[model samples]
Target chain A: MIPAPYLLYLGHSDDPLGIKTSRGLAHFVPASCVGEFRHDDCPLTVGMPRMTLAEGKAAGAQTLVLGIANPGGSMGASLVADALAAIRLGMHVAAGLHHRLRDEPELVRAAAEAGVRLFDVRDPPPSLPVGNGLPRAGRRLLTVGTDCSVGKMYAAIAIERGLRARGHAADFRATGQTGILIAGEGIAVDAVVADFISGAVEVLAPARHDDGWDVIEGQGSLFHPSFAGVSTGLLHGAQPHALVLCHEIDRPHLRGLPHARVPELAECIDANLRIARLTSPDARFVGVCLNTSRLPEGAAGRHCAEIAAQLGLPTTDPVRFGVAPIVEEIERCFASSTPITTVSA
Target chain B: MIPAPYLLYLGHSDDPLGIKTSRGLAHFVPASCVGEFRHDDCPLTVGMPRMTLAEGKAAGAQTLVLGIANPGGSMGASLVADALAAIRLGMHVAAGLHHRLRDEPELVRAAAEAGVRLFDVRDPPPSLPVGNGLPRAGRRLLTVGTDCSVGKMYAAIAIERGLRARGHAADFRATGQTGILIAGEGIAVDAVVADFISGAVEVLAPARHDDGWDVIEGQGSLFHPSFAGVSTGLLHGAQPHALVLCHEIDRPHLRGLPHARVPELAECIDANLRIARLTSPDARFVGVCLNTSRLPEGAAGRHCAEIAAQLGLPTTDPVRFGVAPIVEEIERCFASSTPITTVSA
Candidate 1:
């Protein structure tokens, strides 16, 4: 039987499995983690609803990772997972398929506590390798929506226009791609693929990635709140240098819903940042790229700018004044060797 | 025996079941209208996949609803269902859980072709009749979200603030005398009841629905794409002069993940507007709202301004833009008998 993921009971002495993954303790306490916990037939304790560990030695899984919601649990689990992954022990952490960031902190903390060094994973920018040396500069950005008709193609078109307005080589490169797996299409997803290719040839002039060009790629629906599967492929071989989030802003407020405005936004950023930090603290945030839409208006923009300001980066449009300023800010942020500080000043 | 819903073969004249609801008909059709037709169940023909009237009746009693899709041969069957729903002689059309407004045009045309009126039977909105009389001057607004944490409550608060800024008295009031139901604080759903007296006193001052005040209520979730009963309740019974949506704006250029924006906010509004027009053609639109956090500076404000302007309404703040402008716009739009245009102007 394969060993299922285990949840360490550090707080209470009634750990049903009698497993002690943590050091410096005989008395038990609930480990603070809320991702996937791997164990083998370990019945749940510490008042957690019992979860039946899957039986059998699955093909790719050697050690199971269980999720915990206790305080500081996430860090513990991250630490453990990181250490195991680093040592090539083949540890698999079961991340949340769908849940709020607020609900996942414990899971994150526990992972940290478990000697796993977590890392945020983000897609690499569009670029081409030049002469087998380094990435060459590519200015066009491509982001796709998770589901069809959710504005992936539309946003791509809009962003291309914004980039070209800045005199940069940018455009969508969609050609043959057709319908999305989710919802039927109002606009063809393939059109953008054609645009991406055409734009690359026209603007970038022989697209190459030898010097790390700034091409933003959209991971449509891969990281949705309720879905699983973190795209490690997009993370540039698991060493993401920067993490940026493109999400709906003031969603609650825009739709006239209820929420903690600044905090919720901050939490979203923090969640992404945490993932990045787990991967590598050396990696920092570039800036939030707000895809301007008719949805939440100024509220989301202002908040994004505030987040950027808090991150000690130059905000192109402090008031979310316009997109041109954002483009300029992104260019400026990427130009620096050191972490980007306030650009407005 | 119950007769299954049937699809008529527009030009064919053979009865597979050797029976017809209408005597002397070319072919026999089921009694019910509308049924689920899967993707693979397409390429249907007139003779093949024919329903047996007697077998269907033997299984149950009256009419049958057969669900199909947008395919070539399916139109013939659709016509049959349409015929049944239209006549109004103890006939009902069940367009089972219809979603996606883009699909509505074809659906409407299909229904019209078959001479039937499709009625969506989704759940009704959660409201209580608290006001003694409807306010004569201002209007009532309802804030609902596609899902919890989608920002329904926050939008309500912002609109409230906006109304106050515009020298209008707007407040939160439940339809009934109950407060929002919170789990863990009370028993499960079974033990749950609308605590109106206690809730009203707490959420609103005396929570009286007086004609002098414009009331906006907050609801948890509205089943989307399929804006059935819940949407209808808010649009019809709530008698909202206008609806407000606060959704997240996706910025893929700077931010990375796509599909982070929930289902298209515009799509949701479009669907609601279509449904609303059926009930209240005179109902006017105030403006569109969106959050800016996911965007860079300048983008959010400009986008909001653009949308509101394009939609033919005044820009909220463009600076301190929030739900306030939405409320203000709604008020302004409804102030006169004339409907408000898009913000483009």
Candidate 2:
């Protein structure tokens, strides 16, 4: 079992992109990976500290999360050493990297000796039956993104919180480990057995709750070269009536894969709608959820405005600006189809 | 490892549908399941005999395959008894039913005592990574169906055989156990990790074989409630340049679900094209592979003609009329784009 309130580890990284994502995960989702931020040499602009294992323990770090996600997803010699060190330091280590700490013989031996757990977020599940989501009809809202790790989960949680604040009977459906931890329960869509990928969703968002909406966390992207299939299975399985499209403005290209470019905001919107409409014909693009934290002052607002104007949908960085605009559109959609009372985020 | 040339067992049954498919697999693909056919009450028209385990051994049965597959896929008490008796006789038992023979406690105990093996065809694979098949340039042809068990694998094998007969360089990519056993090597697509469903196809039909065509066997159905996700993953993963829509003339409804009606042939064709074009833009519907095995007298020929005239595509039951018409379109599609030279079935 994973003991929460983690120690975020930003190990020595040569790659620029890996550094950005690791920092982003820590800076944005601070509550999930709390306690002391450990790094070898983080930038001055970031404002994180370089801490030793003893220093981390003094700060009450229950678990040390490997903050560095490799650029090419290659499992190498260096990453394993860092995780091994963390295990030896009497910390339950959590990693979201492609290189699983559980797979390393030395790391497993150390973890067992220390009586600590190693949580690999990317591990696919063991068994699943092929799903029948077509027959089930319940309200679900999903977040789609232009690239991986562009704040789909964060946006979903924010919208769910906003709706909940207004006293609505809405729930957030987590599709990944991080979201699952935050929400307390969810199916890891990517980890499910291939035949049961969509079935996993069917099981998660059962058709029983007719009065409330299920704000489902989405995975990957339609344009991502390595994980688009997960995106498709999720789009079909969730069968969302309304979709919030998330985009990372600073990302010029797909993460890791240099050859693949992120689809244009318009194209991403259209493609997701087309795929979702295959199963849910009434599927509509409700709003745009922007991740413009990396952009300079006044730029994030301007970017949201321009895209919102062009697409004729309300847009905002759900984290900074509040998810009221996106949540409003969803509330509007649900209001017309069903007799629902109360305003949402 | 699967032992070759199985002893086909048609257990006691009243279901006409189960009998036909069993006989068809044995008749069409004799090499995979090699020994004498066994049944308790063999009909005269079918031309097969009821044989005891001792008789089956005398006839050189290496493995006993539970030939009767229920429409609802239930493995009853009697079927388990037959399999246990076969195991005691020192024959490896193989079943394709939903009620996994390997899951039964008594069967497991009996198998251990007798030194035998059990194979469950519907078991999904261990773990799989997501696929990126969009970059591949290999010429691939997939057989999609209106519903499950509608001759997709049969059609793919026939087309590959015909292409090979005409001295064309082509290979059949298997996605299921029967096809895997037929080809002697293949990852079960349905059993693969959900995130890696499409990825499995990418590994199977890689871009290296740019010169030759890959006749890919399809699974489940885009319209089947229990398995549409498999259909979506395979379609996106295969990235086929040309797709053949397979249909059975006598299927009144989807396999087990009576509520869900089979989609019209035209609608099925359109839906598949829309889904496939998401990844492979140049993908086209090359032909219609009909399964008119149950059609009486001259009705099968008449039905083929009507569909061929309406859709304006080459249509035929690959088993009955040979896969010449379907192969003609695939060859034509390939000749214009690639340097492949040959006439095929």
Candidate 3:
């Protein structure tokens, strides 16, 4: 697990989407974020005070988090130098990229001399079990998406907070790097072995004895050819009693594939439900989460209202508005009794 | 690639299913099989003459194939000793178990000293692309299943042979260990990283100018939660114009999970077609392959006829009865015309 009180590294990234990890950590767990670090060429910021490696260490930062993503998830030479600096200062370095920090010989030697740890958030734990599809004791709500990066993690985190605020027991279950960092521990399901995709999720959110809600963060869309398998596995493993359909307000196409168009919300919902029912027979959609960052205030409100009316589900932007309506729907659907303890392996 | 003229290592396995690799090689590629090696306690045989490592090497065997599977895919101490013995005899050792031969220091040193290679068939090749989901050229037929181990690979191989016998150009694309051994080279899709499951399959079966067919051997069922992700990714990546549904005559529950019931034939067919359509828009099932090994001849015939009438598709046991009906259906559906080149990325 990555040590908290992080120095969020933006590197040379300028795109807002590239710095989502830092932004997520800053917005959700501000107390754990000590400061931001970036070069002069980088313009993106998560609205935190700036600091160098020495300054961040002095400010009680325990780790340097590489919060920016680039094409192919490669680590640049400049970034490697910065990570080396952090290692020299006796602070750990963590990254959620496909490239592992431990693979670099220079950084490995430096970290060895300084006795600092390296955390690869994308690496799954060893010896993950195959999914049994057995019924477990717990209420679960999974956030599925219309496409990748459509605010699935945001909705799950918000829903967990909302449920807790309403005197209900709940915890956010992370399935990606950003979510794992925010939750401090989780499996990057996408990086797991293909055979154990569902199995990793099964272990991440196992049988809970408290009958509380496990707000599971979903991954890629069921319609996304690149990662639909991951999404399908996560769905079956989660076996959610309630599902929150996450969608972007104005997606031109499926992410990174101009040749493929995004599937309709109804079709996506049907597919997800059909697949999810293999594990959780009573799985159903409880709400819709719209990533309305692209739309203006009035337009976002109108779109949310129209979609909610058309689909007969509570719809809202978890970032701009809130997930209270969705939490209320979840409560309405699964009241005092537990709904997933009928079958056991 | 594994060198030919293999000495199949049974490794004291008694169950027939445990020795599927040897059986598959003996049945599909008899020319490559020099002889079989087994311990005294082992009763299983693929009907090949028994030979020791020296005897097999004298018979011109170049590789020693560990053709038996044990629990957890582990290499026992006895098996390691045997592998080392084979390596000392200057025979390249190959295994498809989860435990890599390269990970065993004794085997590695022995192979290095003997100037031999260790082939881990389950190890996926590096640098596989993420699936683009583009409509590729040529016709393709993928074998989908109702559960794991329902004879998808056998059906695919049979169909490819049948298509060739009918003067059609077809190739059997392997996706598992046994199929890989038979076909000589393939990526075990299940062993690939979760994110690249579909991508690996895409690389395995690429665009062809000849408008031939790639009969891809399918993996786990869409209903089998343990491995449905691999199956789904394979399905999406294959993008077959025609699908063949595979099932066993009488199965109790989903493989390895007693609590999970197998899905009905109609539901399985509909789900597969719906998912396959994301890439191949006109994808449809052309036939059903039943594994009637458990049924009597008359009962198996009756079952196939009944299912064929009910589903309005050709249904036959690829092992008991040839896959001629399925290959005929494929020919009828995709006759003399290019059906998959309408869209390009």
Candidate 4:
């Protein structure tokens, strides 16, 4: 779990990935949202953007996590200004973004003078050799999304929790921001160089003599218009035996681009299997984790059922329900003589 | 044409994209290969490595292009030593590899002292806004490959020449080191950040009021086991109105990787279209450019005929024969209301 004292400065926006637009961060990590800072030029959104940097400190905020995953991975100028103010108020700043806050000379100097740690979640791992896509002895299950921000990380985390509940030794390997914050380590797969993406995954999920299951958080989607490259790289890199398909039932189009429609669930599954088999010849789709928050009242459970019937697979809202089905499938498939793809040719 | 004064330097290895495994450099720009340089420890190959840095300078070598694209990018220490020596000899060093020589302090200092430039072909362009993938008025024909180093640049150059002969305005857009050297300006698509790959293409092929066809040199292959990401980004980034598929008949497997076989021509074409159409809905494959240098002596022309018969498309070795067939297809398709994918749509 992530540490409590952190100001999620939305800077006049309501759509930070972890926080609910209406609830103002009530759900995910309780009491973690101490303050909501805003730029003067922008109107307040969601819960009133009333808390100042000083008030956040008074409220026991220890650090500021740039909670939003902005497109193009850059923090805009207004957010940078708010971040600087937070650093001046003696708050450690952390940004899990493509553009590093540490890269800015002024922010670097201010953070240094204020004695606050500026953590960039996307710091690339040291150079790695190309991934041979060899299978690991330990069972590795990766959660790949239908698109970015479709709850791949959340699904992986939930699946891991379910595995642990069943008295299994399970490890969660994060490949993005929120996961890194919760798990305290792992490379940002999208930020990695093109050639080294699979190599980085190989490093992240090394073969364990224990053969304990490792749930790998995936990034991007093979059908995503802009980010499919990252998706393909991660899929090919993680030569996993089982995969959890994640989707937001309400997403009509790719997150940012209107031109890119989300491929049909069947199409996405076929595309992923075709690519995944390039490395893992027998990669199997374990289950489907749907984010149904955007659906109208009472539509969540029905959406899950419809998908379950349609794909003939276990389907549920990992957050509203739980990942028990997915976990059971993984353990059963990996622990038994299930004909999983092995690394040795 | 690539500038005359630059010397081609393949350190230790005789392979630099193309040539007989033994004869280091031949066929592309005559007398441009001053000599091969090898560190004392590096055993000589492809005719004894005989050129010293001093000898290269005396042979009128104004620049040293790191001709080989090494796996995982970084040059060996011996090559860096050779580069530093050339820098000291007042020769500008240019590397087309993903590893930037500009990152090295010793070479930086040596180049500064010698007052010579360090040209990194893979340097990212000035950051640009995300591409909207709108239909541009100007016709853009991109040369995509079945694998890297399959003469995409050569095809683009040849097509541009043929288009000019037919009294049309044609421009060749280079997207790699060799093409950049030939065209004098273009981004190395592989070196670019993932988000910016398409943006760079948008910049490279901006809308022109004049109806000119921009012939773009593509990078990597969509089916390439290692660099599919680069390939995907380049294909979708260029959003070319028309595509020319470049293939080498003798590439039994993807470069470097032994198990990843090249897809069949039809499969490759379909896969590229599926990805490319995500950005440009109606993008079409105009022709094929085959590099058959590795084939038996007189078999090149016959193979081209067989492929042309099979695909029912114009096919030729643009370097050996010409790109006239490809130019004709582009003009036939795009010069009129061909129901092409519009940028604005």
lDDT of 1: 0.34
lDDT per residue as tens, model 3, A1-345: 678899999988877777889999999999999999999999888999999989999999999999876433678899999999999998999998877899999999999999999999999998787888889898899999999888999999999998888777789999988999998899999888898889888999988877689999999989999899999999989989999999997789987789989888888888898999989989999999999988999999999999999889999999889998998888788877322332231
TM-score of chain B of each: 0.41, 0.87, 0.93, 0.87
Instruction: Tell me the TM-score of each prediction against the true structure.
Output: 0.25, 0.85, 0.92, 0.88
The candidate that achieves the highest lDDT relative to the unseen native structure: 3
- Give me the displacement of residue A259 in model 4, in angstroms: 3.5
List candidate 3 stretches off by more than 4 Å.
A39-43, A50-61, A70-72, A76-91, A113-115, A337-345, B12-15, B39-43, B51-60, B70-72, B76-78, B88-90, B113-115, B337-345
lDDT of 4 by residue, A155-243 (tens): 88888878777666678998877777767688887777666667778788888766567889988777665677677777777888888
Error of 4 at B108 (Å): 1.5
Ranking 1 against 3 by TM-score, winner: 3
Each prediction's DockQ?
Answer: 0.01, 0.36, 0.64, 0.40
- Write candidate 2's Cα lDDT for B1-345 as tens digits: 568566777677656556544565566666565444545464422344445777876677777877666533567887888888888889888776656777898989888998888877656544344565456766788999998888888888888888777666788998876676566556667666555677788777778554678889998777665566667778888988889999988688787666657888898888788778757878898888888878864888888899999998998978778888777777677674332342231
| Candidate 1 lDDT, B156-263, residue by residue in tens | 546665666655556644321011110001111101111111122122333234332434443322222111122233343344557765454552311111222244
Scored against the true structure, residue A122 in model 1 reaches a CA lDDT of 10
- Candidate 3 local accuracy as lDDT? 0.89
| Candidate with maximal TM-score | 3
Q: What is the full ranking by lDDT, best candidate first? A: 3, 4, 2, 1
